[model samples]
Structures are given as C-alpha cells and as structure tokens.
Target: MALRTEELMLNMGPQHPSTHGVLRLVVTLDGENIIEVQPDIGYLHSSVEKMMEHRTYFQNVSLTDRGMDYLIALQNEEVYCLAVERLAGIEVPERARYIRVVMNELQRIASHLVWLGTWGIDLGATTVFLWCFREREMIMDLFEQVTGGRLHHAYYRIGGVYADLPEGWAEQCQRFVDYFLPRVDEYDALLTANPIFLARTRGVGVISRRDAIAMGASGPVARASGIALDVRKEEPYEVYDRMQFDVPVQSEGDCFARYRVRLEEMRQSARIIRQALRGLPPGEIRTRVPMTMKAPRGEVYVRTESARGDLGIFLVSDGGETPYRVKIRAPSFSNLYALTEMMKGWKVADVIAILGSIDIVLSDVDR
Candidate 1:
C-alpha cells in the first residue's frame, strides 16, 4: 500500500473567540503544520448587496452602512456616496469633501486601533489591547459629535455630506489630532520594542511581494510586502491629492511589518486630517439633490482607500431611479485568500496571530 498522507483536520472557528466575528475555517493540517485552510464565511450573512436593488437612492444609504456594523455609518455612507457620485457625475463642494475626508480618516485611525487592541488580546498581550481601545474611544467621541450616533452616522450623502460640520467641529478635530499624534509613538515604544511581540511577529506569516500581488492582497498587507499599492496614493480620491502624506512600505512582508505599516498609517491619517481642516472652506455640505434621482444609462465603478483596503462599488444603471446592479468588492474577502499559504508550517496557536494581522473583517468577507 502507498504511504499514508498523514493529515489531521481541525475546526478553528465559527465559535472560536479569536475569529472576532462569525467566521469559520476548515483547516487541514499535516501534524502541526497547516497544509490547507479554507474560510467558510456567510455565517453572519445579511445579503445587503441583493437588498440594495429595492431601495431608492436616498433610502438605500442605510443598507451599505450595515456591512461592517463596526464601521457603522462612515463605512456605508462613504462608499455609497462614491457610487452615487460617479453615477450622477456631480462635483462635491470643497467644504463637504474636507469634512468627509476628516471624518473618514478619523474612522480609519479608530478602526486600526481596534485591530491593534484586539490583536494584542489574541496574542496574550492584554494591556495593549485595552490601552489602544481607550485611545480609539477618543476618536469615536469625535464621530458622535458630528454624526450624532457613534456607530452608523449615515451622514455622508451623494454630492456632499448630509449637513455642514457641527459647531466647533474644526477646533475639536484639531485638538483630537494634536492629542492623538503622540500616542502613535507611545504605541511604538509599547509594542514595537517589546521582545515578545517582535519574536512572535518579526518573521511569522511571511508573504513575498510576488505572492502578495498574485494573491490579490491590498492595504497594509500589500504595503508590508513592499508593493506600495495604496488606493489613496494611487487613485487620490476625495481630496487625497490636495493632502500631502507618505505611504509606508516595508520590504519585509511579515506580520510585524504589517503591524508597523498600520501604525505608520495612523500618523499619516492624522496629518491628512489636519491639512484638510486647514483648507476647510465655507460652503453647502450637500449639493441640491433632485426628488427623483436617476443615473445615466451607463455603468461606472468607484473605488476608495478604505481602512481595510481597496473598497470598490461597481454600479450599473439603466436610466432608473435606483441601481440596477451594485457589486461591492470587499477587500477582506481578497485579503483572506492568502491565509492557507501563510498558515502552512505554523502551529495552531499562531493562526490567530496570523489572521488578526491580516485584519479580515467578517462582514466584509461575507458581503
């Protein structure tokens, strides 16, 4: 008889704590090494994509926001505006663009902080997790001031934002950025220098530049691999061209490099927010929208540099009041594709650290 393949199988999640949400992974292991890993998503499926067809332009704003209930309003409204803006061929007002950039960058920083904190907890570094979340709360407070709700603001609409910046918003944003800037270095001193973190992450879950590109990775994952592919830098959407900031790239595409990339990105985001505020002009937040919204009988795609990665909305209109087809190419779904390759030859415990570093949000994966 032929020699045995010597395979062992384990279910890592669907109920595992580190999954971060409803995600399941069927991993095939050769002894202690992972040979194959398949992500079984949609356990939290809400089918938001299919539902977008029924709602009108304004009424559908709330649907897209529902994808990552964690990013709440900023996640949905921002992408939807890009979709609708491309459809209507409208030029958003400068003030609205400024405010949108400010809020969205803040949200990106907050989102990364949550990732940092939670990743630490999964790796047994509990203190960093708590400290990071504490800082993230400060940014969330800023979101509440302008958007009213902390989670889903639905504040961004087509052509412009829902309304002007709330009173003292600029001053408050300036204060937040100033207060937040030093904390980036604080995190560096806390985690970057810690030997335990360095050992666990320095060379683990390594991916090459060619491998990352072939795997369709984006955001920090692709950046860490020295690809330097950032939608913000590449596309320059929503006044990104007007702002000056460097995109951090690491030649080492290991887990540690991914950590450093996001940390550096937060500092850049803070810088962008400050400059946008400096250029903040006085104008209408929302351009005049018609009662019956209709896109031309053509198709267009708009992409944005979301905190996760490249978030794209492909919109198809048949000269109708609502989108005929809307396809959301969620980055997490693509980013998670490399997990099998990354997990091979690693221990089971290291899987959490690896997955968390990729920062795959389940909603983004499922939808």
Candidate 2:
C-alpha cells in the first residue's frame, strides 16, 4: 500500500467569528493545507445604490452611514456630499473644507482602530484588543461631542459640515492627537515584536505587486503590496490638497506588511489632524442651499479615500430633487475581491490571519 489521501470541503462561515461578518468561505483542504478558498458574500446586502435614488440628496447622507461602511460614516458622507456639490455647482466655504479634512482624518484613525482591535482578537492578542478599544473610546467621545452621533454621524453636509466645531472641541482633538501617537508605538511594542504574531503573519498571505494592481486593490491593501496610490494624494478631494501627509507603502505584501501599513496609517492620520487643527481657518461652516434643491441634469462621479480604500459615488440627476441613478464604487467590495488571491496556497490555520488583514466591512461588501 503506497498511501491514502482525500480532499475535504469546509465552510468557514455565515456565522463563524473568524469570518468577520456574515461571510462564508468554501475552503478546499488537503489535510492541513488549503487548496482553494471561494468567498460567498451578499448576506448583508442593503441595496443602498437603489435606495439612494428614491431619497433626496440630503437624505441620502444618512443612508450612506447605515447602508454602507458604518465604521467610516463621515467619509461616506463626504464622498456623497462631494458628488452632490459638484453636480449642483455649489461652493463649500473655506472653514468647512478644513473641518471636513479634520473630521475625515479622525474618522480614518477611528475606523483603523476598529480593524486593529478586532484583528488583534482574531490573532489571540486580547491585550491588543483591550488597549485598542481604550483609545478608540476616546476618539468616539470626541465624535459624540462634535457630531452628536458617535457611529453614524450625519456630520458632513452638501456644502459643508452640519455644524461648526463645538466649544473646546478643537482643543480636545489636539489633545487626542497628542495622546494617540505614542500609543501606536506601544502597539508596535506589543504585537510587532511578538514572536508568535510574527510567525503567523510575517511570510503568510503574500500577494505580489502585479496581482495587487490587477485585482484593483487600493488604499492600504495596495500600498502594502508596493502600489503607492491614494485618492487623497492622487485626486486631492476636499482640503486634502492643502494638508501635508505621507502615504505609507510596504513591499512585502504579507499579513505583517498589511498590519504595518495600517499602523503607520493611523500615525499619518494623526499627523494630518494636527496640521488641519493648526491651520484651522475661520468662516461659515456651510453654504446655504434650498431644502428641496434640484441638481443639474447630468452625471458625475467622485472618488474619496475612505478607511478601506477608494470609495466612489456615481450620481445622475434628472434636474430633480431625487437622484435618477446612483452607483457606489465601494472600496470594501473591490478589496474583498482580492481575498481569493491572498488566501490561496496557505495553511488552513492561515485563513483568518489573511482575511482579517484585508479589513472588509460586510455592509460595504454587500451594499
């Protein structure tokens, strides 16, 4: 007798904690090694694009929050508002632009914190999970103080933010930024140097630069794979053109590389926040627009760098109060498509490590 072998098909989720959220992974396994991983998505679909067509442009801002990536709701609002503003030929005040940048950067940091904390839990670093949430709570407090809604803040308006920074809000934001940077180094100390973490992530889930680009990876995912592209740096929406920050890039394209890129990105987000606060301008926070405003009869597409990647909104107006057609180019959807490439040829144990590294929000994927 030479040998006996068989392949097994395993379903990882639809409810499993490691699958992140309502995702099903049909994995083909040859003993402990993975042969193929097919992701089954759409369990969380909200049909947000179709819903946007039935609501007014102003109403759609709140929809974007709950209907898509709820983690970075402000960024979602910013991109949707940008599309409407462009289509309607509205001018956002200078102060509002600066405020958008500040809020957007803070949103980026907060969203990344959620990813890091959950990922830490996935990797069995309970301390990292606790510490990450400790800091994220501070950011959440800041959001609640300013926007009045911690998670789904309808803060960004068609031409500006819903309101100006409340009293002491700027000072508090400065304090958070000052306090948050050192903590990132502490995270580095904990997970970045741990031998177990390194073993699980260092050479695992490797995706090449060419495949990353071919697969349309963006934001930190693409940057981790040596593709140095960012919508803030490339397209320069809102006041990002005025802000000073560096786009972090890594060439290794492994699970560790993805972790390193996101950690550095949190630091850069703080950097951008500090600059925005320092150069905070003064004026009206919003430009007045009619409650039932009708945009021009035309189509416009706008892209913004959300917490995940390139978030885009394609809007068509029939010179009416409601959108004629709305299409959202969600970053999580594109980033999730690259999962198949990342999970191939890894051990069965490496699946969670690779999937968590991508940071996909189920709503964003299914929207």
Candidate 3:
C-alpha cells in the first residue's frame, strides 16, 4: 500500500510566545516535517531612521534607545554616537574610551542574559530563565548606578559617556564580574550537557557556512556556522584592539552550536570587562560637546560589534544640528532573514528551538 502526504500551511504567530516579539511565521509542513518558513515582519515598524532625521543629534540618541533593540540599548547609543563623533571629528578622552568599552561589554552580558533566560523559557527550561536573570539583575544594578536608567540608559553621548564613573565604581564592577564568572559555568552545567537540551537543539535547523554568509547572518548565528566575521576583531573599534579576547566559532550551525557560541561569548565579554577595569585610566569621562552642535557636511558609516552582531549606522549631515539622513544597519534585520533558510526542512517542533537560537529582536528587525 502507498500513502500520499500533502503540505499543511500553518501560521505560527503574530502573538505566539516563541516568536520573540510581534513576528508572524507562515510555515509549510508535511505532517510534522517543515517544508518552508516565511517570516512575516513589519509588525513593529516605526520608521526609526526618518524619525532620527527630524530630531537633533542629541535627541536621536534617546530615540535609538526606544526604537532599536531595547535589550542592547547601550550598543545602539554607542553606534549612533560613534557615527556622530566621526562626522564632527570629535575625540573621546582616554578614560572615557576605556569606560565605554567596559560599559558596552557589560551591556552585552546583560543583553545575552536576557536572551538566555527567554530562550530557556522557549525550550521549556524554566529554571534557567530564573537563574540567568538573577545575574542579569546585578548587571542592571551596576548600570543603574552609572546611567540611572536600567533598560534605556542613553549613557553614551556624542563625544563620550554622559558622566565620569563614580568613585569605587570600578571595584564594585570587579566584584560583580568575579561573582558573575562562575554563574556562567552554572548555566552550562544546567543546560549544555542536559540530555533533553541536546536532543532539542543538536542537528536541528542547520545552516551551513556558505548559506550563513550568503544570507547575511552574524553574531552568534554566523559564528556558529563557522564564519569568523566579527566587527570587534576585524574592524577593532573602541578599545577592542587592545583587549585580549577570542571569537568563539562552531561549524555545526545548528541550534546547539548557536547556544554554545553565545555561552562562550558571555565568558569572553566578562574577560574583556575585567581587562578594561584593570587598566582603566583616571581622567574626564566626556569631551566638551555643545548640546546644539552641528556636524560638518559629510557622510560617515560606522560599524561595531553589537550583542547581536555587526551593527552599523550611516549618517549624512547637511552642516546642521540635525542629520539629513540616518540609516541603521540592524544586525537583527539581516539575521531575521536567515531564519527562512535555517528553518527549512526541519520539524515543526524544532521551530521554537531554531528561532530562539537566532535571537532576533523584532524591533531591531522592523525598525
């Protein structure tokens, strides 16, 4: 006897918990096997670029916090400020530069913790969600002490950071870093060797190195697929060139590989922060930049290694206080497109595992 199977079209979400945000997935399935994946975006679109053009250079920094990936708001501010600084030919103080590196790396850890917690929840590892956030709270507390805003810090300014690091802040940060290093190992103990996690993530939704590069995946996703494209190492922005760290890579390009890449990144980020804190200089945290400053008539594009991956900003100044055009090269936007390629030919249940692994933020994608 012979039996025929027909494809079933299923809509995973505009509201599903695993979609991460307001993203909808139109998936084709033959029984439990996935035939194709079409990611439906634009649900969170707010024309962030157009909005940036209307606001002053200073105002746009705050706008970036709200519009882009809120989870990594400091990185968003860092890229914007970096572009503006280049256009205006501003020089950041040595101390401010080191502080920026330290703050940005801490922000990376916080953002990754959020991803780990939420991803764990998606994979039904409820305990990991709680454990990841517990350390993340300490990171947030450190940020609050410095920037006064836990989520949307807007701590970075045009020339440098908003203010100098408070007294003993470095020591406090060091204490937290020392405490947090072991917590990462605890997370590995909880998830990496767990039989259930390996079953759910290993060999599911594989994206080969060629496809990863061809489709523009980055950060942990592309690195997991065996691509060594990292803006921090290749471009060497800020104090990254001085800091000693490694770019973790895996050839598997599956859900578990992505998981491993991020887990390793947390350790590297902690290492970078420790180094920055150890060598932190004493000086002014910010350079003198007027609030109503006008950038020279020029166009500049700057790229930085954000938590997700290579985040870039293209700024065009008409010799005015406000920008003429601002285009944000969001890593999540490009990373989201790779989902279709990765999700193809996988089972329906593996969808959550794969999507969570990619770590796309809809606001960053849709902005």
Candidate 4:
C-alpha cells in the first residue's frame, strides 16, 4: 500500500513567545516541514493614526514614542518632528541637527541591542541576551541623563530638541562608544563561530532581493538581500548627508545574513555617533515655537531610517493645531509583510529562528 499523508494546521500564536509581540501565525505543516505560513496581525492596534488627528503637533511627539516602535523612541520623535517642522516652515538650528544625529545613532545601537538580545533568547543563546543588555543599559543611562526618560523620551521638538546635552554627557557618550565596540567582538566570538548557531541560521529563511523589494522590506532585512538602499544615504536628512558611514549589505538574504547586517550596522551607528560628537557645533538646541503651533494648510510626507526600517509619516494640515489626517508608513509593518515569504519551506524547528531574525515590534505593526 502507498504511504498515507496529511497536512496539519497549527496556530503559532497571538501569544506564543516566538511569534514576537502578539502576532498570530496560521502555520500549515506537512510533517515537520512548513508548507505555508499566514500572519494574522492587529491584536495590539491602538488607532494611533487616528489619535494624531486629535492631538496637537507637540503632543503627538509623545504619542509617537508609546504608539509606534518604542525601542527607538528618539527616531520616532525625530521623524514626527521633521514632518511638523517641514509643514510649518521651521528651520532647525545647526547644533540641534548634530545632536539629533548623535541621539538617533545612539538609539539605533540601543534598539538593535534589544533585538539581538531578545533574538539570542529565542535561539537558546542566553549569554548574548545578557551581554547585549549590559551595553544597552549604558545607553539608557545616557538617555535618562539628557531626556529624563529612558524608554519614552520625547526629546525631539518641532524645531530641535527639548534640551541641550547635560554636563559631561558628551564625555560619557564617548566613553560608552569606546567601551561598546570591543564588546561587539565578544558577541561575535560567542555566536559567529558556534556550530549550532551556524546550522540553524546559515542558508535558512532566505528571501530574494526581488521579493524583498516587491514586499517593501527595508533596513537590515532588505540590505541583507543585497538591496543597497538606506534613507540616510539616499535622502540625506539632518546631518546624515555629511556623516561618514557604510550601509552594510549582504547577498545571502538568509537569517545569518540578517544577523551579520545588523551586527555591522551597530558598528556603523557607533561610527556616525563618533563623527557627530567630533563635529558638535555650538548653538541653541531648540528653536522657540508657540505651545499651540499650527501648520500651514497643506500636506507633507517625511521619511526617516528608523531602527527597524524606513519609517514615514504623512501629515495633512488644514492650518490647524492638530493634524487633519495622519498616516504612518511603519517599517515593521512592511518588514512583517515579508515574514510570510521568509518562513515558508523551512522546518517547524526553524520557525523561531526565522521569526526572530526579522525583528518585528508589534506596536509598529499594529499602530
């Protein structure tokens, strides 16, 4: 008699740890091999876009922090402020621009640390989780020193920042940068040469360059697939055009490639921060604006390279204090769209490894 076969349906979760933040994966399995994966999202939706319409431009900064990708809250603030500044024809001061760059890069490194550490836990490499947070805590201290809020710092203002760098903040940041680079190598030593990690990540969860672009994947996900596009390099917002850094790219497009891209990106973020610190200009950190500032009657769209990917905001203003319509092109949402493409054809055991590689934040997805 011929062999008998059947496909099984498994709900991976709106609660499972590997699903990474309230994502539900309706997974189809033929034995241990995955036949199809359909992602069910929106369990964490907060209607933040709608909320922006009722909040003033200034109040929306804080909303962006909690409502979007909270990992890199400063970047979220930067993009939102940039939109409001453009719409209202406000020019940010020179010193403020450099400070934004510095904080933005620092936040990028911090956010990637969170992703790396959590991903390590997902893959059973608990040491990486411990070591990554060890460094991230230092960055958090730096943030707390300046912004007074470690997690949700609404530091970026419409024209610049909420305050100037506190006393010794620059020196402290320099110390952290000097200290953090060597620690990255330690992480490499642990995972880069590990046989088990290599077996699980290498040649797994591969996505082609064409598919990555077609699905609107950005940041490390797209760059890992050999798409050499970064908004910092392409659009040149703030002081990024003047900064010297490399946009790391890999052709493998596998989980290992994603890991390598993010690792190198952390190094590059440090590079940008060093340059921003070295070229720190002297001027006001924030430009004075009315508490109830109203933008002109027009619409503006702004894009910033967030820790996750290409974060964009479209603001429609009717010469009012609050935005008439707000639409956020969250990078996590786009990157998550590519997850289904990445998970198919992999073994059931490789699901967590693959899901962890994309690094999705549900807040960004559901916002």
Q: Number of clashing residue pairs in every model? A: 2, 0, 0, 0
> lDDT score of model 2?
0.92
- Candidate 3 at residue 2, lDDT? 71
Per-residue accuracy of model 1 over 118-153 as CA lDDT, tens digit each: 999988898888889888888878888877767777
Best by lDDT: 4
What ranking of all candidate models by lDDT puts the best one first?
Answer: 4, 3, 2, 1
Model 4 lDDT on a 0 to 1 scale:
0.94
Off by over 4 Å in 4: none
Worst 10 residues of 1 by lDDT: 67-76
TM-score of 4: 0.99
Go through the candidates in order and give each one's C-alpha lDDT: 0.84, 0.92, 0.92, 0.94
lDDT by residue (158-227, candidate 2, tens digit) is 9888888998899999998999999999999999999999999998999999999999888889999999
167, model 3: CA deviation in Å? Answer: 1.6
Considering lDDT, which of the candidate structures 1 and 4 is the better prediction for this target?
4
Please report, as a residue range, the 10-residue window in candidate 4 with the lowest summed lDDT.
Answer: 12-21
Q: What's the TM-score of every candidate structure?
A: 0.96, 0.99, 0.98, 0.99
Clashes of 4: 0
Better of 1 and 2 by lDDT: 2
Error of 3 at 194 (Å): 0.6
